[model samples]
Target: MRVLFILILLANLGVYALGQGWLGMRPEDEGRDTRRFTQELNPGAVTLTPRPAP
Candidate 1:
């Protein structure tokens, strides 16, 4: 049971480190425009909003 708890703790810590970009992992480059044209969402174009709430 103690070993299982330690493994879980280590796994959680690793995930947190990776998510926060720690432990020699390079931080994300913010200068790059990563947006793709194909992924654009146009809900206004497809669905018309009713003037009154239904």
Candidate 2:
């Protein structure tokens, strides 16, 4: 159906937009420290405080 095709096209476009950051998708490791840490981050760390806010 035409409606289904349009929906699928829109969904694909949304995925492309997200992948390209047009939808504001953030990298999970964007602000992570590039230097090696002596220990791994605890799973229970509050707000994922690895190094510091960028």
Provide the TM-score for each candidate, comma-separated. 0.44, 0.47
TM-score between model 2 and native: 0.47
Model 1 lDDT tens row, 1-54: 999999999999998887686875435744545565457686567866679977
Give Cα-based local distance difference scores for all models. 0.74, 0.74
What tens digits encode model 2's per-residue C-alpha lDDT throughout 1-54? 999999999999988887777766446546767565656677566564478778
The count of backbone overlaps in candidate 1 is 0
Which ten residues in a row are the worst by lDDT in model 2? 25-34
After superposing all C-alphas onto the true structure, candidate 1 shows an RMSD in angstroms of 7.2
